[model samples]
Target: MDPEPRSAKGRRTRARLVEAGKTVFERDGFLQARITDIATEANVSHGSFYHYFDSKESLFREIAEEVEVRLVSMDDIAQDLTESAGPVDRIRAANKAYLAAYRKEAKIMRVIEEVSRYDDEVRKVRSKRDDYLAARLESAIKRLQADGLADQRIDERYAATALGGMVAKFAEMMFIGGARFDMNTAVEQLTYLWANALGLVPTADQKVPAKSATA
Candidate 1:
């Protein structure tokens, strides 16, 4: 790997290369992306690409790390809403935030997912992101249980893992697999399922009408 650029111009140039690499990778994929295309996209010489990154793989690893950071940060943003929201509302907000982020980065995320299948470094980064999300969900579940909102009998770890994975896979399917789903409906249904899975009791204000027996 190249040393971090110190000068302002050098840093800008390096940043451009990274951005260009992402575009090229997303366009051509990991196996097909070339340093020449990245340099051309960045408006830099082929050798300049080498001055910033050792190889395409190195640049991709950096992007993968960045994506992981953004993903984890999205989770944090959702958690920030917890203090003011009820259980269902909080879960709905989290799902909305996650799905929005996934839609925005679907192309690059698809590339990262494909690369992680064969690249150990990328796979580790992906795993680390997943673990962080699961940990946060686990903590939230425990809090709900402690507050007498969620069922105490459920194992937090298993529930967290399952619920987190469910949301993630649902996002992947809707965004990457081209499954057509309305965002509002998706968030509502996911929130409903998550809350019910944990046996969350709704607050009085959130009560819904009961279905008739004939219906």
Candidate 2:
């Protein structure tokens, strides 16, 4: 493992190298990407690259960790919504945010997924990311059940795992697998499925606002 950069300049150089690694890895893939390419892209010396990362794989791991942070933060869309937002609206917002973030990072995500198939460490990182998301979803489902908004009969853990996997698979298919579909329609359909699965229904007094059809 490489030592942490203590100085501000060292931190900036490390961050630049990480960003450069992402660019090269997305363009040339993990097996084909080289430390020289990353160093060149970052406008840093080859020795500087070693100062931050022991190898290209180490740099790629750091990049994957950063991607996980961004993907996890996208889940906060539901929490950022107003209290009056209906279940369907919250689900839609979260799905939209997740899908959008996934799309933005699709290239790197594809590389990560490919590498995880054979690399044990990378696969562990991928599993950790999925587990974190599923745990959050489980908590949200439990809250819905407690509020009498979702089905109490459903097991929160299993429901969360299944539902979260559904959205993730859909995202992989659409963004990574090159499947074409209208973004707005995809979000609406995902929201409908998620709500129906949880048996979510708004009370008579809960007025759900209209949403734009435009993506």
Candidate 3:
């Protein structure tokens, strides 16, 4: 169900609550952060918090939802793919897109990933987000097939999972380990990995490259 309409000011007030709650949870974790802290952060009463969210868990779920929703968009991805100079560029765009989203909201992503390790409720939300990302990758793969832009040798679904798994695992590692990973390295390594796996041969026009097939 949609969130009930409040006056614009009231809606803004509730939004602040959700946003603040998300920040706190990302900083302190799902179990550690309290609704009272969120209430104070939002400049709302603890009573007013109930008016917006049923519980802290529900607010955390919403934060996870917001982060996952930004991960992939097949529609935008299609444009990036076609406009790319070659398959290598397309692969880079795909990786860059994934990593960019990951880096943009790594905090909330970490919260969702970390809490999900122990909580069934959080697991459900994380599963939903994974499903959504998988669906988008599947769609993007289907579009590539239809356009004759991608090779038919590989199963697009399988390729999507393989590719998605690589980044997903990397992000999970970043959440777990103290690492100096950055977006550029993710874009470069993931693109190289995907391209080499796909047996893609890129020409000079492609901004970066994987080495020759027989080399």
Report RMSD (Å) for each prediction in the order shown: 4.1, 3.0, 4.7
- As for candidate 3, its clashing pairs are none
Best by TM-score: 2
- Tens digit per residue, CA lDDT, model 3, 1-215: 12554589778987898789988987888889999999999998889888878888887877777777777652355666654366677767777776666767778877788878887877887777677767767776677667676676878778877777887887666544556565566667777777666656556654653433320
lDDT of 2 at 79: 63
- List the candidates ranked by lDDT, beginning with the highest: 1, 2, 3
Write candidate 1's Cα lDDT for 61-172 as tens digits. Answer: 9998887778657655555574667878888788888888888888999999899999999999999989999999999999999998889899999999999999999999
Which residue segments of model 2 deviate by more than 4 Å? 75-80, 202-215
Error of 1 at 56 (Å): 0.2
> Best by lDDT, which number?
1
Off by over 4 Å in 1: 75-83, 204-215
* Candidate 1: residue 32 lDDT (0-100): 98
Residue lDDT tens for model 2, 126-180: 8888899999999999999998999989999999999999998999999888888
> What value does the lDDT take at residue 153 in candidate 1?
94
